[model samples]
Target: MWIRALQAVLDRGIRQGRLHVRFPDGRMGSYGPGAGTGPEAQLMITDPALPRRILLNPQMALGEGYMDGGLSFPSDDDLRGFLQIAARSAQSGRLPLPMRLAHGLRVRTKGLMQWNTLHLARRRVQHHYDIPDAFYALFMEEDLQYTCAYFRDDAMTLEAAQAAKMAHIAAKLCLRPGLRVLDIGCGWGGLALYLARAHGVHVTGITLSQVQLEAARSRAAAMGLSDRVAFRLQDYRHVPDRFDRVVSVGMMEHVGVPQYQAYFDKIHGVLAEDGVGLIHFIGRHTPPRVLSPWFQKYIFPGGYAPAFSEVIPRVERAGLVVADLEVWRGHYERTLRHWQQRFRANEPRVRDMFDDRFVRMWWYYLIAAEVSFTDMGMVLFQMQIARRSDAVPRVREYLYPAPGDDQRPSDTA
Candidate 1:
């Protein structure tokens, strides 16, 4: 029955022109006969142990299997994409009783504080982003923006979409040429440098990762933006300087529900009276006491996405007016798919740095995120906010620039 089910999946891929199978060992067999050629061409998994290892002990076994010559792929990255697509489809079907029971167990035991707080958060961040910078460099475009790209139209590429996201956020903030802008949890300094170099805005970017901080600072220096854009190795809670504008992209997931109000208050305290702030974050459909056990254990620790029900009240208590709230649920699905493709395309390099299980874990993470957005309709929100008493119009709408137009010059502070 399992063979039949697996074959059905392979057949779908074959019919779609997404897969082709061949045997390189010259062994005649009834199953999947004449799939492909060459030592690396065959889809050679006859033993049940390999598949069982992948399924039962997924966190560690997959990586060990890959390293110990248990599996081979023409492209590891491509394999990641293929498995992601397949797993998502498979997950859509009704899960068996055992699987449901297992899920329930996970939910019941979720969110116990385990590792020392600092070490736990650090490990979680490292597991996902600590892949060698070069590995990320292969997939991310020149700017290395590691967040959701905002697509202006269906035709825009991921890199172009990302650039658009940066431009969009910058424009909404109305950054001035000499105004100080703070980027909380700046990833790779893409947006910070964009504001500093392109718009002549002085920017300060804060991050917890020492590696990220160094890379961002170096990039700023290389672009001769050292004087205008600065990268700091500090936590957002510790940042004391006031700025004309503040922007945080894809970072709120790290701030759990208990800390949401404190996070907002910090932003409120750090903003100049006339300052505006933009928060771009992944949002959840329902409120959960904590994140999923599987995600918390294997993926992001101390990470929880809150719904608008939780966010709106917190923001109101912080004395901020919501200028705008835009949700892009579909774009994130497309974005995750793009990342999966790039990760698959560059698997050889990835394998060199991390073990097979690590690869599969990431594969699952990316694909599952894609599936969540598609199946559950998860949302990505960009909120524009300002001090509640500010005289700015409550319903102001600004036009985003067309792709080919010259980037608007920054306002003079």
Candidate 2:
């Protein structure tokens, strides 16, 4: 009975990709079109409870099972391929009625997972970003940019792409010499340093992660830009100054939906009357009213990727005029692909840092994130806002620096 019921769930959830499942009792099953014919995923169910767990809730159980050794794939590469296919098929799919109600109950009881209180917010940021810098360096650029990078040129290397991302945001800000800029949720101060050194602005960066704050401060001191750039261990809500520019990259996801208006209101209050601000975040193509259970439990404690529909109204209410909006599609897929490659190459070090289970979980997180960007209608949105009507130029050409107007780091190692 479990086999037939589980088979039905698999067929509905993975409609197009082929997943060949070998049951614990030596029974075999194939699901989806072209099943067992050049299948992308082959699963070995070692525990009898795996199917029941999946039936109760498949979206997250699969990852949990993999982490706990209840499920196995032939290889890590195949595992990623399988997850990509599964996530793609599950994008427009639905879980069983019982499963939906169970998940809903779990979400309601765990409301603490999505609230970013001042004290708790620091802990939450540390939960994800407090890892040693070396771990991130394994997959990220030398700058240690821990956010989505803009890859304007497909052939560009990750380092160059990251540098270009800084330049892109800098140009969009319409910066000038001696202007003051505020960086909310600044990870490692790469963007802040770039703005200060390249654009001649005094950059003040704030973050809740102590590890990130130290690294950023050290980097600024080493680069002799400490005089122009500074990093503080503080929350955005506590900031008590105004600036000519405000920029936040990959930070709003942690703010939660309830704080949307407060976030915009604070940004509006902080900006000078003629200040220009830009916000870059992960947005959904279709609004999922609820956050994912697995993501809330395992990856981001309070992260909720909001849709523009949920974001635009708050900006209007805060009296911030939308200057421009850019939707970045498929670029993050390529970025995650690069990160996955680097992470794969550094497995020996990762294994040394933790165990096989931890390594597997990390790989699954990276793979699932890549799948989200590629197939789940997930994209990056950069919204430029201003206080005064004429704060920014009317034309968009100012955002594109001339051939030699800006300098980027070398792509080659």
- For residues 54-96, write the lDDT of model 2, one tens digit per residue: 8877767888988888889998667866776776665544656
Q: Which 10-residue span in candidate 1 carries the lowest summed lDDT?
A: 31-40
Q: Write candidate 1's Cα lDDT for 1-413 as tens digits.
A: 44444444344332211333332332322322233411112344534455555344332443344444554555645455444443343344443444446555644554343222445555666666665677678667778888888987999999899988987887778766788999988878889999887777889998877778788988988888899998987767778899989999988887666667888998899988888899999886655433444566676776766678979989999988888888886888888878888888988778788776767667667765775666544789899888754524343433343566534434333
lDDT of each: 0.68, 0.83
Best by lDDT: 2
Go through the candidates in order and give the clash count of each.
Answer: 7, 0
| Model 1 ranges off by over 4 Å | 1-120, 286-290, 389-393, 401-413
Q: What is the lDDT of candidate 1?
A: 0.68
Which window of ten consecutive residues has the lowest lDDT sum in model 2? Answer: 404-413
* Candidate 1 backbone collisions, by pair: 21-35, 21-36, 22-35, 22-36, 63-356, 63-357, 77-344
My TM-score estimates for the predictions, one after another, are 0.74, 0.92
